[model samples]
Target: MSIITTERLCKYFKGKKALDNLNLEIPKGIIFGYLGPNGAGKTTTIRVLLNLAKPTGGTAYILGEDIRKSRNYLRKVGFLPDVPNFYNFFTAREFLSFIADITDIENPKKRIEETLELVGLRNEKSRIGTYSRGMKQRLGLAQALLSDPELLILDEPTSSLDPQGRKEVLDLIYSLKSTKTVFFSTHILSDVERICDRIGILKEGRLLLEDSIENIKKRYWKRRILIEVDDLEKFLERIKESLKPNSVEVKNSSVVIEVLDIQYTLKEIPKIVVQDGLLLEKLEILEPSLEDIFLEVTSGA
Candidate 1:
């Protein structure tokens, strides 16, 4: 089931369009990566979904309930905004306890301790004012999940973390995916690639593409064959004769070929390589990454 959806969603600021006629469906119980460059409207879309901000035109739904009408639905969602503010005077444990109290949660001491450990900040019992930016972000995440929410909306979830801190948070977020739905928005493509089951690429306030990781790679990116042939001239000639025009390029005694059908190319490549008496030093298919797809879609080049 689709836990989050937006239909022709549009959000305008004064006269500027931040989100334009956007349509998206995020499946339940899966990590949906919302990707875009800065000012691409990723945060705007998220805000609308949470009902933190109203949309100018169109509608949004979360957990099958209209976002505008379902104020109580917020209880089922955990939100970590790009920048999370807190009472710095409060210690880590105290801050968590405050949230638990406001949410009317029972037995919050145990829950607070559990969440603190879950974020790998169990040892930091000092005031939050002394914590690092990364620690604050982790604390924000801990608070978001304190309710044991069914849906998590995270914006730049790892933006403030060091490598180790980021990894710890990511591991925690991934662990939660088994039981909760996550909508992770970030400009960091690598993070999305690591944890996202499906991704939507938004650019200039519009969703340019939305698809599974596998489907995006298959549709816009393909595996390439890199071959090292013994006789450069002969190998080049044979490839030209046997392969489609402009498909093969010879570079430094290595031939890189772009083929539409990987299986057919694999079958035919060995024959051509052998006939040309190539060394076969390295023959492998290399697929494109999410970064590659992101550049292609956003640049319009």
Candidate 2:
């Protein structure tokens, strides 16, 4: 079942369209990366889903409930904004206790303790004002998860942290894949590749593409092959005749070939290598990064 679904959901500001007929469906138990460049109305989409702002055109459904008709879905959603606000004076435990009280969470004490520990903030005794940005972010996540919501909507959860901090948060997020449907919205390509199972690319408020990462790669795979061998010159000259590449170039010790048909080229390359008695070091397709595919779809180039 889809935890989040949108049907031509749109939003506008002034005379400009922030979102234009964006239809998206995020299935359950996957980390769905909502990818877009800056000023692509990512946050605007979140706001409307959360009922912070109303849609100008079409509507959305969260956890099978039409957002236009129901506010009940809000209770099952956990939100951690780009920059989470906290009471500066409250310590980690104190702050979470406050949140639990307001949300009326059952067995608040046990839940708070479990959440703090889960986010690695259990032993922290310093007030929120004394925490680093990474710590603060984790704390924000703790609060979000305190309710043990079925769906999580995170906005750029690791954009500002150092490498270690980012890793900590990412590992924590990846661990939750079995239990929660994560709508992780971000511009960070690498993080999405690292943790997301599927991605939805949005540009100018319109969803350009939405699919599993593996499927998208196949759909937009760049037709290029990378081959490294000890005998680069002989391998290159022989492979050209055998594979009939559209174009080929020698970069350092590897032959980068552009192929009209990648699968056919792949099979033919190995045959040529063995026939010529050339030692094959590495031979593989040059995989396209998410950023590459993102630009390809969004720019229409």
Candidate 3:
């Protein structure tokens, strides 16, 4: 069963639409990346799913139950917002303890210790105000996990961190796949590529594309073969005479051939090069990166 599902979900503010007939389904035990540029309504969709905002139209469900009808499903979910606020005076242990009490979690002390360890804050004894941005983010994640939720929703969880901090958080997020379903929204395409199992791209309050990383690459991206030879001109002529690629261009010291049929090109290029007596220095097929795909899809280019 889908852990989360939305049907023609719509949300409008005054006359502006934040979401327009957005339909989505996230299955269990996958890191689902919600991707879009700024103001693409990713956060709006998340808010609607969490029942933090009333959708102007349509429906949404979590754990097979409608959020509008019952908020009980919230107990099974955990959320980490883009910018998490904490009581500056409270230590990490104290703050989490406070959250546990409010949420009525049983065995709060044991849960807090386990969660802190999970986020790599087991030894942190300083106040929240003294912590770095990365530490604070980790602490926020610890609070989210205190409930031992089945579904974890995060909004741009690594937006402001440095490279090391991003790595830390990403590693922690990746570790959740065995135990939780993660649905995170981010404009960081590389992060999506690194950890996401499936992704949805939103643009102008609408879903532009949604697919697994591999399938999306195969479906939307063209394969370009980059070949470096002893002589660029000779190889270009050989390519023209033998392969007849859709497009061919000399880039720096190499020739890049764009082909419609990857299998045919791969099979035929080596034979042509060998026959023409051209020295092959490097032969590689360049697959389009997630960043490339995101720009092309969102820009409609």
Candidate 4:
């Protein structure tokens, strides 16, 4: 069953459509990536799903229950916003204990200790003010997990962190895939590529594509063949007339050809090169990266 579902979900602000006719189904136990550029209505969608902002049109459901109907479902959901605030005066343990109490968690002390350990803050006795940005981010995650939520919705979780910090947080997020459904929304393409099982790309308030990472790669695979030859200009001219590939470009000491049919191109290109008596040093097909697909789809290029 889908852990989250939305149908024609929309939100507007001052005559601007933040979310437009969005339809999505996020299955349980998968790390789902919600990707888009800034102002692409990513945060707006999250707000609507949490009922923090009322949808101007359509509806959203969490765990098969409509968010507008009741807020009870929130108990089972954990959220880590892009920017999380904390009381600088409070220590890590103190802050977690406070959150536990507010949430009416049973045995708040034990839960706080467990959560501290889970986020690698077990030995932390310093006030939040003394914690590094990365530590604070981890603490934010610990607070979100305090209630043992089934669904964890994270917005730009690694936004401003250093490479080391980003790796640390991403590792923590990866560890949760076995136990929780993660809805990770970010513009970081590499992070999505690394951890997301499925992804949905949003552009100008609309969902342009949604599918498993593997499926997307296959579906949008660009058959680009890169050929390195002894004479770049000669090979470029020969292929332009003989091969008639979809597109051709001269790059430094090599020629790049984009073909519609990989099988045909692979068979035909070599034969043409051999016939021309030109030295073919290296030839390989180039796989399209997620960033390549994202730019093409979002920019409509």
Candidate 5:
């Protein structure tokens, strides 16, 4: 089941198109990474989906209810913006208690205790003012999950944290996948690679690609072979004419080449090396990374 759907959803700001005819669907019970470089309308899309900003064209549905027509979906979602605010002077338990009272949650004490424990802040008694940035982020997550909303919307959740803090927050998000559908939006490729099952790449307010991480990588997979030889100069001259590869570069001891035909290159390189009387030191296939895929698709393809 789709937890979120957008059909030709668009948002314009002061004669600029922030989102242009975006069509997206996020399935239930998975971490959906909304990836893009800066000014790619990631935040704009989130705002429209949350109904925080009205779209200039088209519409969206969250939790199966049309966002334009019903507000019932809002309560089913929890949001954590890039920068989360807190009552600096309030204790973790105190602040959550206050939120619970305002929201009329039953058995606030038990729920608050469980959430704090889940976020690794159960025993923490320090006032929020005394907390570190990481601690504050944990508290913010505790607040967001206190309601136990079905879908969690996070914007750059770890962009501002130190290495340790980023790990802590990411671990927390990864742990919630079975219980909540996480809509994770960020430009940090490594983080997305770590926890996201699926990703949608956006550029200039248009979604360029959306698929499972493995499938996307496979579809864009180009063979990159690292070949090291005794005669670098001679092999370079011969291979260009014979292999006709997409690209070839010398990196330290190895010459990395993206081959057009893996079978041909693998079979032909040995013969060329023998003909050129060059020593074949090493020949290995290099794996494609998410960064490589992101750059390739966003740049043109």
Candidate 6:
């Protein structure tokens, strides 16, 4: 069953359309990735889904209930916003304790300790203000996990972190999938490629694409041939002889060659190089990376 669903969801601010007929369905136990560049409605969609802001049109349901009318439905959800705010005077422990109490979590003390440990903040003895950005992020994650909620919504959870801090957060998020559904929204395309089972790409407030990461790559990402040679001029001439016209673009000794048919390209490559008597420094099949796809999709918008 889908833990979250939106049908033709739309949101607008003044005269701007933040979201336009957006549709999303996230199944339980999947690490769903919501990806888009800034102002693409990723956050707006999240806000509407979480009931933080009402949608201007359409409807959304979370955990099988209408979010707009059911305030109690929020109890089963946990969220970490892009910039999580906390009481600077409160200690990490105290902040989590406060959340537990407010949420009416059973066994609040044990839950707080477990959540802190889960986020690897169990040993950090500092007030919220004293913590580093990474540490604060961990604390925020601990609070989100305190109730062991069924659905976890995170927006840019790893953004602005150092490499080590990013890894720690990614590791923690990866570990939570066995027990809860994760709806992760981020512009970090690589993170989505690494952790998401399914991804929804939103652009200009519409879902441009959604599929398993592998399938998306297979469908939208094409394999191309990269040829780095010692003889730039000769290689170009040789490619012109038998290859499709205008299929290659050269930059010095390297050329970006779009492989029309993988098998045919591989077969013809060696012949073309040999015909030119050029020494191939490197000949590789380049699959589209997430960065490549992100650029291709968003650049035109």
Q: lDDT of each prediction vs. the true structure?
A: 0.87, 0.91, 0.91, 0.89, 0.90, 0.86
User: Mind giving the per-residue lDDT tens digits that candidate 1 earns over 1-301?
Assistant: 8998889999999989999999999998999999999999999998898887999999988888888777777889999989887899998888889889988778998999899988878889798989888888998999999999999999999987888888888888899889999999999898999898999999879999999999999887655778876676777677667766347767787878887677877888789877666676778786888998999989982
| Deviation (Å) of 135 in candidate 2 | 1.1
**How far out, in Å, is residue 219 in model 3?**
0.4
Ten consecutive residues with minimal summed lDDT in candidate 3? 234-243
The candidate 6 region of ten consecutive residues with least summed lDDT is: 238-247
- Please give the TM-score that candidate 3 achieves against the real structure: 0.96
Per-residue lDDT of 90 in model 4: 97
- Give the alpha carbon lDDT tens digit for every residue of 1-301 in model 5: 8999999998999989999999999999999999999999999998888888999999988998999998778877888877888998899999999988876778999999999998889999988999887788788888888888999999888888899888888998999989999999999999999999999999989999999998988887779999999889899999999888899888987799998789889999999999888999999988789999999989983
- Per-residue CA lDDT of model 6 for 1-301, tens digit only, reads 9999998999999979999998899999999999998999988988999888999999988999987778787999999989888999998889998898899999988888888888888887777888888887888788888888999999899997899889889988998889999999999988998888999988989888888888878887566778898887877777767777436777666888775677887888788778768788888887788887778777765
Better of 2 and 6 by TM-score: 2
Error of 4 at 294 (Å): 1.4
Q: What digit string (tens of lDDT, one per residue) describes model 2 on residues 1-301?
A: 8888999998989979999998998899999999999989899999999999999999899999999999998888999989888999999999999989978899999999999999899999999999988899999899989999999999999998899989999999999999999999999999999999999998888888889999999888769899998898888778777778888888998888898987788788888878888888997778888989988888992
Better of 3 and 4 by lDDT: 3
- Residue 247, model 1: lDDT of 72
* Deviating ranges (above 4 Å) for candidate 3: none
- Each prediction's RMSD over C-alphas, in Å, is 1.8, 1.9, 1.4, 2.0, 2.3, 1.9
TM-score, prediction 6: 0.92
Segments in model 2 whose C-alpha atoms lie over 4 Å from true places: 230-234, 261-264, 274-279
- The model with the greater TM-score, 3 or 6, is 3
What is the per-residue lDDT of model 3 for residues 1-301, given as tens digits with 9 covering 90 to 100?
Answer: 7999999999999989899999999999999999999999999998988889999998999999998798999989999988888999999999999999988899999999999998889999999999988888899899888999999999999998899889989988999998999999999989999999999999889999998999999887678989998878877887888778899878899888898788998998889778888788999998889998898999992
Q: Pick the candidate with the highest TM-score.
A: 3
Off by over 4 Å in 1: 230-233, 250-253
Give me candidate 1's TM-score against the actual structure. Answer: 0.94
